[model samples]
Target: MNIVKSVLRATATTATALALLAGPCALPATAQTPARPAALAAAQQAKRPNVIVILVDDMGFSDIGPYGSEIPTPNLDALAANGLRFTQFYNSARCSPSRASLLTGLYPHEAGMGGLDSIVRPGLGGFQGRLADRAVTIAEVLKPAGYFTGMAGKWHVGAQHGTPPKAVGFDRSMFQKGGTYFPDQPGKGRTFVTIDGRQARLDSPEVGKGEWYASDMLVDWTVRFVDEAKVAGKPFFLYLPFTAVHFPVMAPADEIAKFKGKYMAGWDQLRRDRFERQKKTGLIAADATLPDVLPEAYDWDKLPAADKERFDTIMAVYAAAISRMDKAIGTLVADLKARGEFDNTLILFMSDNGGNAESGPDGRTGAAPWGGKYSNIFVGLNWATLQNTPFRYFKHYAEEGGIATPLIASWPAGIDAKVRGTMVREPGHLVDVMPTLAELAGAKYPARFDGHDIRPMSGRSFAGAFDGKPLTRSVPIFWEHEGNKAVRDGKWKLVAQFGAPWQLYDMSTDRTETRDLAAAHPDIAARMTQQWNDWAAKSFVDPWPNKVDGGVIKGRLEGGKAPGKGKHGKGKRKRAAQAAAGA
Candidate 1:
């Protein structure tokens, strides 16, 4: 019996050794098999966490409640309460460039959206056209890894007839052509869109009604996509870029009614209140200062009564629109929880640019005139000031008010609750999302995909932050659009407006950029400036000439009126009549 038992024990030992040799584990005899590295083990167990990126259009750094605004964004506050909030998150100061950087994991110029253009036109030197066929998006990299991808929002990277989301690797897409909320405009050629491709249109009058806010529509489509993806048993990535709180200041009447008198205290007091709240919430430093009063053109107290009312109403509408957006976000969160996907999903919420202050001195909102060049319902400048609360400059500039944003990321299954409620001061940008998602999903970024030789990713992954580890970025981040440029290497950032001298700041101590350290740190500033110049020479493309000149008027309007419009006098009208007669 002892001999038989010995034979059985020997057989069992042999079987165990062989199994270990063939499987992930190795036999004890096989030269001490090493344990898997922590990073590799974490990547293997990533489970392709469902990715939902929610982008709010034209929202300011302090727009949300948790970010120290008077706005009642309970849903967004709830998101921050349950997730990680980033105080130093950033994006480009404008729309198209930010989207371009976010998707391609490269600087805006590297992705071919060097500057804003409604359409690529001739004579634009350096305008590389839309997102070049060479850039590889996150969708393209993740699709082959058995993940479904969909985008339902603003896709402003390209505007040519054939350059919709599908052409850029999105499996299912529903997006608008331009950046406005004009669904009633002619569908095929007149700008406003409700289509999947270039041809499809929403025939239902329900959606065509003027009351249908763009944010609500976007959220509806997003929720439906989530449901459909779950039914198909496929993990999905949904990019919902809602065009809310942008110009035109339109919202459902009911939502607008809630905030009718909310801003009657005027921007001066409101800015102070918001700034104090931000300090109390620990969102900003105690030493931070309120921006100096705006230039004479923006003196709120000097405006006429009618103008004040007009601006007030416009802001009221804007606030209502964002509140509705918050409600929609709440519904989406509830839906995800209902489906049992909330715990495992990685949901990220951010704005595509800082609050916009593009309204000209004449109070024209956005790029288009109200009633569009054809109507009288123009949005005024009051709302623009309110949009960029507690900040100096607005969209199109490189100031903190224009570029800073709030980022909230929630993942119950992966992020610890204690760490979730904490605010992270590590600086991160929109360009980092693609690589981070790729690393978290264990997906490879191929050298070539779909007939394009992709450029190597310029962004480093922040996935280490999920496990509460310090994130270290090695490369210097750069930005350029229409000649506005910036470079950040650690705490030092160098910036320059178009046609202006470069300025430097130590972001660690002066995030609001009150002090320019250009003279103090001349060597560091010069080195960083040279670095940006080198990057620009490589990635630079000239702005689209025709569209560029059409959008922004170079200098401020004189005499408080647009060019070609005569002064408010009969002599000006007579000169206009003479010119018409000559024509």
Candidate 2:
């Protein structure tokens, strides 16, 4: 393991040589990345790549330029242009579970995070509200194999279960349960983060007063960690999970200005535009059909002019949030290049889940300078339906719209040139990240860690996909959250909404799941349902309505406020929502 760092540091001389070969202005002016010199590329590739896994919150499949969005994500677009874009990547349908899966290379149930971390059902083993002790994180696997592990941003997996990031494996970390974009925003409680194991204000003097943005803060810490890794002379494994494009959504005014009034065309047209773009960019199958706008989505044409204006402004904020994150990414990429680590860094960008429509179909947007819980804007079903273009349902469902996520990987020295700027049609899940990093970093997935028998990884390494090979997954992918269950077995997908019977789709032909084949092919549906049930039972998944706390726990879809709540109860629900959003 120690020898790996030595080889990497020695290989740095080759990167330096290449830099000297180029003039003072080393970076290209255009969007196209320059070709790497053969010798230098070989030298860097021989050593371990600096691994970065970037997860964004509540973003949809087509929310970025590389995917299908009109919103400018120049940095992300550049990465996709220079590397690989995956068309069929999927995430667990919610936040905490997805993070658990991404870190541990296991299904959410196996990682002990089947529900939101805020929902703690004591004695109900699978829904423990945190990561399982037996699961090992990518950081844990990589650190012992000569990597400096660091993390910045939301760490929603409960600290009570498997401890926080620093204790798990990260050498340095700064994280909170949820997002509080502006620390100084009045009436909104500040989110104190655990930094290097110490609790501190998220907005320190280093971040200038009244200038604390969560995305920038995350990137600043990432850059600092990278510099620290350089001093330690080790390859770095940095996890940056940004809390952007999520509820309580906010962005800089100037950024919001850039897209104000731009969404007047509304969800209907924007979704169609994105769908067309997806087909044109080869991010979706050319013959693929777009599913109709969700039934819950508002009719843009029916909305009053004032409502249209309000909707446009809020969507602008959503766009601003994404574009701002993109700008921060550009900064990170530039810093990597300045250190001559850009080519050797394997950067992976993905979303935790699909678009959120938590506040309801109509959505809600509060007054300026959002301070309290539920006080910020939610794009709601209308805009969220657009965000997950050509798909059905929003977040919290076991549908393509909820689970689908765009995954982009960039490694100038590692990815094959033949696949650059091309879309990969192979289906992948968040679980694959750990194994991929383990393979690229030459790290071993241990059988035992900290005297506990570790859970075997459910994911296989998709590193071959980087070289333009197929991601030949042997087993089917499964999902279950709040009673929404699904199984993706090759071309067939069996999905069921909470309290609903299974609906099957042929993913090879109808990736958007517009057509239900279950009635026509009942045999396939029954077989897959059996497979899912068998897997779920063995994987610690409690059946819906299972006993918990000595009572029958009825299913509460979306985990929102109870029904029949009047105005006062509505206020309480909002407060609860605020707490949950931050939690």
Top lDDT prediction, candidate number: 2
Candidate 1 regions with alpha-carbon error over 4 angstroms: 1-40, 117-126, 159-161, 178-198, 205-211, 365-383, 541-583
Query: How well is each residue in 148-210 modelled by candidate 2, as lDDT tens digits?
Result: 899998888876454578666788888865656776653443546677767876566643355
TM-score of each: 0.82, 0.85
For candidate 1, the 10 contiguous residues with the lowest summed lDDT are 574-583
**What's the lDDT for all of these models?**
0.65, 0.76
Q: Which whole-number lDDT from 0 to 100 does residue 307 have in model 2?
A: 65
Candidate 2: regions farther than 4 A off: 1-45, 160-162, 186-189, 206-210, 369-375, 546-583
- Model 1 C-alpha RMSD vs. true structure (Å) is 11.8
> For model 1, what is the C-alpha lDDT against the true structure?
0.65
